[model samples]
Target chain A: MLEKANDWSDTFYDKWKPIAMGFVNGAEKCLQCGKCTGQCPAAAVNPSYNPRKIIYDLVNGNIKRVLSSVELWQCFFCSGCFATCPVDINFPFFVFMLRLGAMSQGFGWEDVKQLEKYAEKDYLQDGITVSPEERNPYVIEERGDIADIRQKAGMPRQREVSDEAIAEINMISDLSGMTNFMKKIGGVELYDCSKCTPKIEEKCKSKELPKKVGNVKTHYRFYNYGVPIGGADNA
Target chain B: MHKLDKLSGIREEIVADIPIPEEIFYFQSCVASNKYPGIESCTLDVLNKLGVKPFVSEDQTCCGGFVTFANVAAPTASMPAVARNISLAEEEGLDICAVCNGCWTFLNEFGHFMNGNDEVKESVNMMLNMMGREYKGESNIFHIGAMLYKLKDRIAENVERPLEGLKFATHYGCHYLGGGKYGAIDDAQHPSFIQELVEIMGGENVDYTASGECCGTGFTQVINDKEKSLDHSQMKLESVRDEADPDFVIVLCPYCLSQLDRMQQQLDYRRDVKLDIPIIHITQLAGLALGLPKERLAFDAHIGGQDRFKKALNKIGIDY
Candidate 1:
């Protein structure tokens, strides 16, 4: 159950001021119409991941709980909610900001660590994120074959980023604080999952989760809210 | 004001004017260039055939959008990279034409952020100044999908082989349509631009219920929560199969193309259903209609549905 707001606090709102001051008034215009929840693809598959409730919590100043919860990370950034939003709230961007806030508070670091292995490593080296050199053997072979096919098709074997461009990208990554933030988060301890639901705990203990999810291999634990709220089930 | 009145006012603000450029910077995508080079090549071929000059620069780097979307970095962290990339296009004095939805949406969204936030713009420009570049925000970023839609008439005129007797279902992808407030070319809720393109190419447009649904290549979700991601794709593909059994599923973005095309094999194994639908990029579709060789379209890069695509072509009596 959502915690009732006996006394509203602007502390959380003040920390993320740009959200409120900027686009769509930071969910202030939300009419609780539940249109965003209805249109969300993530919510459809995961009953625990509720966009409407997240926005409601944000509006009611239930920041601490929302930021730390696993529901914050469930959004795939599809922007379906934004398209269906009556007032055009841009829920994906809102979720993006919320994820950032969660990260700052030492939550969702495991997910970022996974990204470091899959994307950031290659992105830092080459100007591209998912380069074939660092991928699995299948991908490397497939990419090499594609390169051959591209050559036959009259295109370059692969996109060539100039040495100067690579240097510029490296510099931008450094100067923009990405390098430092990554290095800082690298040493930070993972978010404690013990506080999460028993379902996630069981999945973690039973070790039934696949070593590889989709394309990349990860030990990241997926979470679920304890129960369905108001019996809402889109699946 | 009434709720409907407010909604229309907001819609009026975001419905962007479509501009047809004679030349575009042609921002290349990492995924398309690596996994599916055909999308890049086909986009170039189709655009050139439609009289749009595509200039690709070696100086431009990745948009670094994956880092942000993957939850590795904040949008501000990639702002400098985004600025630098757009500055490269601005330096050429041409608008950007991104073949992939990720490239255009990241450029446009981050570009919009930098445009609105003076502090962010100043900081990002400061970093770019170190590289002897500055983002002027003059160039407008356009997806090749929108550009193709704008040149539908020209495409219709140059159709050497109309895609007759072929049925196509369209997937506009999430970023191209759902990346909000950018004044998308079509209605985000009920987008029919790709369907319209298919019809113009002499193909039948098959309607499906999950046309507006995501393809489930959620940058990190596909990696972290694979079940949910695949479940979403399964739902969409099943809908396309059951409701509209088209010869091909047309998509605008390479990410969507890769997800929907590659996942059919996974879905076939996970479920008892066999959805052997060939997923084709709109540019590739246009390239086919414009009489480009099948090799140039590079259908070989795709994983599943090759046999079905060939059978469909054989049925249509169209030989490359």
Candidate 2:
């Protein structure tokens, strides 16, 4: 571990100050007790993904290595580690900040481009992220069916966001630099069903063919680690 | 010692007995309103039956959590949006009652962030000024599950349909219990609030080994990393199936409901794993106990375990 500190610099702490601010007391507060790794759902599934190691690297000023690693994108942000941490490190917040750092450095665009599409098409247009009408035909039809059921149930067809509220939402998105970030990441290109073969088009329409982006390997099936009862002593 | 002392104080405040409010601003969720509208309706129905008046506002939009958690943007980018939504509740002079865990946790965490960082709060307030709104961090955000847990006795008194002879397994989801920074109403590691509510509703609680694990919706993970996402859900489902074959699983978040319900079918098709347990939001179960009709519960919207759920309801002499 000491040998891994060769890349450390005098200005390292100051350079990575923003990311360290995400943690409760800075990443150096991590006790390195391995308790967080024990409770991490991502670590249980993927041996290569360790929260303790991430904290260690951050504390040792390995910003480039930590930001460039594929493991940075694998955290579920479940906050299980935070819940069990003795010092309350808030690992999810730290990981979220690290992901932002990774994004600014152009490391994890493929992992988040689909999200970019959702932000552009759904959130920007409707002020909501999961608007089924903005999705494929199958989802649109399913949403319609849900509306009919809601009507039969004597509930409103849908929750209404006033035009004023939606306009304000769009303004907030723009003013907060969210719209700029989406554009900076390269706006999602619309998928043309006409260009695909009939079979592929059908699958594409159903959103089953064009797979999601990411390269995180999960072994949840083979690894049957019984419930992770967390504590440093348990670790 | 300083951090631990502060946390312990927060924990004490969390565990203190507080009065349940009679009225609250109902914060809407994107997934619940679009995909599972029943969860929204059931939330209102149960709240009404409990003599709680929930003010549903048309001026509110999505919680903007999916954007941040999905990695589409940073937390700071969504701070203004979160402040704007919470400001609506503040304007009403009422606490917030959120039906979805994502909305509940996001609102609270973001509110906590703004309260601590004056500069960030000032900037967020400046952004909100464009809409003639400001976030004072005045309203307390509470999940409907926590509200229901606090009103367990009231719930028991209004049980028109007792869930007798039914066994329920619960998935608390990650955001509500684990993502809380200030602390939660119950112990995060060993929570029994749901089980206590199950008992009050005349249902038996089934214990599973992986009760505390995440459902693995992971926002974007389900879309981008389907295999890994489904694998996490598969682990929880298999544990519940092998340990205790509950009649249905109860969840607090709409995202967890979608992931656990829809992914069971995916697992059946992909891995041939036969875990056909029905998944229902806590409000849906509360709706049934309050004697709401089957159509109002909207079990039809679910992708898996509807038939099994119908059979279980039939055994209790209730028509599906």
Candidate 3:
């Protein structure tokens, strides 16, 4: 059963605001502009997947409502919104925050857990996410004889990932809270702006930088836009 | 509004500004390798033909962009993983080049992250300290598509089989065009580099609405909301179909190619619709124009069959 959110206290925002600000900036500045939805390919296909409404609900502290909704999962993260937003909101990253909030609470677990296979594959194989034809017959059928095709093209088989690198990545994952985060134990901290260099801090602390409030600081640190905030104490 | 123009022409000045590097560390895509190995091989073939020999390292791992960006894992793990990947490239003393947009965007964003944030860098270095690896953040990350665009004239001079008279709708994948650092390569919304390549290769560039639209292979959306995912691809295809009938849709990103290629079949099956437009990577198209064999180009691997492209090639007198 989905965990019902009867509590709409400031604590709700406290828990989510840091994580949300970790990826996206400018949720507070959304102009009620339908531009994100107008440009959204997902919105064009599915009327319910509205970026504007998502932003609207988010700022209003409807975290659980937004996180639990099917519309939240419908974002393609094509970043059409990021491209169009006058405020330069990374709507995809905003959607990502909602995903993390959802993941933390065990919502949409079954839908997204399948990606764990690829994550594990990437770790075990050193860096390769999808398994090769021998292990995945569907891959062969879907891609139509990839290994044989490569040989015919005079290309060597895909290079092997080093065991040392694989082991290192495994250790990093273990240490970085990836293993726990995957299992929904959820202690992975994606980004921390306070850790930024002076140069990056200047870059992140732009005019659009939202004012810091109660241990939650906004760092707009995405591709030349957005910032990050360490959410939890450990984060 | 940052106008998202799909049919914008090439910015010649911007193309001129690109510092064409002699050597680069090739960052391979795990999905492209497994799903469409040909995209990787043909990309290399095009690069070599253009006189850029990229170095490949066994130590380089997946960019882990998809997993992290998809929220499958936190950036704590993925950021260090990418930093490690960049470190391997730096050790080789070469700039980083990726054929897929996702890898390039992830590496580029994470590069900025590490470079801008000393504390994150220190924490990541602490983890790497255990592995005997350290990230100094010395390399510049690029998508090979930009290189192809930058070297358009040189590539044109080298073409053996020009694809004359075919109209191509170029899907410049979202990450390549919309992502931060890469947006500077061309007009983010109104990019024309791919169309420029198409024109230089003797093909007509189809100017369509939604040409700048994504193929709808939303990273997690594909896993979580597949119907919505297919709808996204279907919307792009329908927009293309409505506006113009291009011979092929050129994409540089692996995920876009996968979604555009595979989802077309699903859209057809699910809706009984027939929008049979073949999608090819810019590298494959360039490989074909350079007279590489169809086998090397891996045209057979696409769900949208290469029949029209093959026939078009035959008409142009290139037999392989």
Candidate 4:
């Protein structure tokens, strides 16, 4: 609802013309219906991501201002925006495009340094991901299935991403083009995550795997259909 | 494993002269082509028995999805190639379908860029124009999943040898749904097309609830390379095997099938789950139901089906 601004700085316009124009075109057609804003789970938790507002900023050639806002990064890409839009406009895809656009133009990734570490380094080691022993109440509450699977896998439990593995992922990340982009534009520290090999060798001591991880459920003993499926009680 | 779901296995009659198509185009998937040739043949055989002909465009490459999601390449790179391929189908007046979810999804990218993003279309067309190929952007690109759905009636009717007592779960890969703006049919989370097709074929579509989840077949190794013990790749098949409780798992995408079937060995070895769900492609199922020869059904390559299909063939009036 800020005052209409037809004008954009020459520097910002030239840098993000494609991105800024795409957003503006996308937003002006957004219908102001609040479908995307409404369905955004993040919006439910935090009101700052007015999909309407984000689109509004983009439509007006406000690339710098739009990218600078923290609200842009919070979108979950859940497609709630697409489901709710009457025009069937896919706002989440647009938001993703906008984010890529912002990153390409060098305005958005203020906190990309932590992310860059993963992109730059590699560590090859073999160890259980983390000992399950150090897990806290949060682990019990949030990832109970994973925790249970970790235990069942006969894995020593440590919920934290191991220090060694973290170092390795950074090794791998730095080898990619993504790291260079992050380094130049968004000022994100790019890591070399692809190179972490020693850690992988360390973890080569095989252990039981979780029965279910993400969507895949690995049944170890038998395929019984009559019994109640595992984890039916989860959210 | 072979459990029937319907009252009668008999198929409805249709005009014999729809003239099953040939010169068919198969969309090559980054994951499937890389991992499983077994599934690729099964899909082809299924198409063949339905009297349809197929041709693999070997010159065809990855559907540009590796860069699409990351948003690195301009739409021009993808759209023109797709538009040119689609134009070939239109020239043949044939439907172009890819078995892998990602390739099928990129087909939608071609559709959207041509109809929605004119500038992107122009750029793509310009490049293709350089290649002495023209892209008109009118052909329909389908995932084998959608084609199976479109051929549902034909499928039900062609059950010369029905998979009478088979219970299976469905795995609808992510790319198939969100392929592009105009690329999808049903809800991405809970698609019923495969399930319905199972029922039409006289096989029971079991309750494998996590049907829409990513099989972790694509990009899983790259992303999870750091944490070897993490078993992140296991998520693709493990979740469905545990929940669906089906005797066998079915997939339209070869990548999903490979992860489900090949990873079965991994899960059995690594997790000791002994999960042995044989993954079959929809086209294979259709071919079986249509009474294609057992060998014609491409049963040899697809894992976990020889014994089950033998039992099924014993009970049905099969032609092949």
Top candidate by TM-score: 1
lDDT per residue as tens, model 2, A1-235: 0122233454454455544333345567789999888877776565667788778877777666677676777788788888888887888877777776665555556567767877888777777788755333443444346678778878788667788988888897777677776776573333344566665443222332222123321111111123323221221
For model 2 chain B, the run of ten residues with the poorest summed lDDT: B1-10
Second chain TM-score for model 1: 0.92
In Å, residue A181's CA in model 1 sits off its true spot by 1.8
User: What local lDDT score does residue B225 receive in model 4, on the 0 to 100 scale?
Assistant: 25
Candidate 3 per-residue lDDT, tens place, A1-235, comes to 1122234554564455544424556678889978888877766666545788878877877665676565666677777778777888877777776666665454444445556666765554546876664443443565556677777777776558878878878888888878765655222333444666787565332322323321233223222111222211110
Q: Please give the lDDT score at residue B246 for candidate 2.
A: 90
- Can you rank all candidates by DockQ, best first? 1, 2, 3, 4
**How much RMSD separates candidate 1 from the native structure?**
6.0
Error of model 4, residue A45, in angstroms: 18
Q: Note the clash tally of each candidate.
A: 0, 0, 8, 76
True contacts kept of each: 0.65, 0.69, 0.66, 0.01
Query: Considering TM-score, where higher is better, how would the candidates rank from best to worst?
Result: 1, 2, 3, 4
List clashing residue pairs in candidate 3.
Answer: A127-B62, A196-B117, A219-A227, A219-A228, A220-A226, A220-A227, A221-A226, A221-A227
Candidate 2 lDDT for residue A206: 33
Alpha-carbon shift of residue A39 in model 2 (angstroms): 1.8
Off by over 4 Å in 1: A1-10, A19-24, A133-144, A187-225, A228-234, B1-17, B316-320
Q: How far off is residue B34 in model 4, in Å?
A: 3.5
Instruction: Quote the positional error of residue B221 for candidate 3 in Å.
Output: 2.0
Query: What shift in Å separates residue B180 of candidate 2 from its native position after superposition?
Result: 1.1
Cα distance off (Å), candidate 4, residue B141: 1.5
